[model samples]
Target: MTDSDRERWDARFTGLGPGEPGPPGALVGREHLVPASGRALDLACGRGTVAVWLARRGLEVDAVDVSPVGLAAGRAQAPEVHWIRADLDDGLPVTGPYDVIVCQRFRDPALHPALIGALAPGGLLVISVLSQAGDAGGPFRAPPGELLAAFGGLAVLHHAEGHGEESLVARG
Candidate 1:
């Protein structure tokens, strides 16, 4: 992403402020599936809410984002989390064999393979993204069946698409 893109995200987070800790969007009702203790990675982890939640659940957590302001807000909430600031446009910076990986509201088909490769055996992948399915299509929205097309090989535990969002929870 460009420096202006980073600045825009920083400004947006500055306006939104720190977020409350919560389960990853796709894991909201199925929180039981998350391992009680394991390594976790939150990609494009804006404000680090889900990352902090994972840490609180007794998991080692790494939260990555492009905005320093957002990372700072999350770091304040949980100093234990390893907060990484890097433009995802540079590509996935952290290698992994993570037990749980989450990417919410961030769509990059280019990283799908890297994400799947990062998971440890029996690891869970939680992802949510804006989608055109059941809504007026837009440039940023994924086409219908996008997540399934990209991740169908995994053992999908949950999948939902509608109302401008697509979410999936699958085991690697």
Candidate 2:
């Protein structure tokens, strides 16, 4: 991301108050897929909601985002989860062989390889992003089959592309 992009995200986060933490959209009904104990990573973890939820699920979690304001809000809500402030444009900082990895509502094709590399074998990956399939949207939205093609090596458990959103729940 450019300097302006980082600043924009920081400003947006600063303006919004912390919201409730919750499960990944794809894993809401299939909560059983969440491992009982394992390490997890939440990329672009705005306000650390999903990170906190993972911690509550009994996994050690490392959450990363570029916005310090968002990180602070996450820290306030879940002090137990480690919060790391890093620009993802520089690449992922957390050395992860994590059992679970999540990246929601963020899109950067450049980091796709790194995301896959961060996961351990047989690990679960839950990802969601804006898409153009269901509704005509802006350039940030994923084209059809983007998620499936990106993480195709993984054993796909669930994949959906519609409603201007795309989500995938898969195990590597």
Candidate 3:
């Protein structure tokens, strides 16, 4: 993202309070899919909700976001998580063979390859984004079948595109 775009995100997050602790959206009902021990990366991890949950689940976690304010809140709440301030638009800074990779509420097609490459063999990938499929959202949302086509190589555990959201849980 451009400097202005990142600043916008920072402003947005700054006005909001820290998020409640929680597991990744895709792992809500399927927590068993998460490995008991492994490394995790949370991209665009606003306020570190998912990152903190990963750490609580016994996984070392790296959480990245462009908003320093957001990272600060996360660090205050979950000091165990490694919070990295970075502009994901530049590219993922994490060099990972992470056991789990999560990208939530952030969409950038150009980063897909990097996300896939960061996952370890037999690793899990959890992604969720706004979608146009089930709801009449704007152009930023994904169209039908976008997630499946983008991550077809992985063994899908769950997939849903509707309600203005698209989510996928897969294993690479």
**Residue 22 accuracy (lDDT) in model 3:** 91
Model 1 global lDDT (CA atoms, 0 to 1): 0.93
Q: What is the C-alpha lDDT of each candidate?
A: 0.93, 0.89, 0.89
For each candidate, C-alpha RMSD in Å?
0.9, 1.4, 1.3
Report the C-alpha lDDT of model 2 over 3-112, residue by residue, as the tens digit.
78878888988867776889989889988988989999999998888998999889999999988889998998889999998988787798879899999988888888
* TM-score, per-candidate, Cα-based: 0.97, 0.93, 0.94
Ranking by lDDT: 1, 2, 3
Q: What TM-score quantifies how close candidate 3 is to the native fold?
A: 0.94
| Candidate 1 least-lDDT 10 residues | 9-18
Quote the lDDT for 54 in model 1: 95
lDDT of 1 by residue, 106-150 (tens): 999999999999999999999999999999989889999999999
How many clashes does the backbone of model 2 have?
1
Runs in model 3 deviating more than 4 A are: none
Residue 147's lDDT in candidate 2: 92
- The candidate 3 region of ten consecutive residues with least summed lDDT is 9-18
Tell me how far candidate 2 lies from the true structure as C-alpha RMSD in angstroms: 1.4
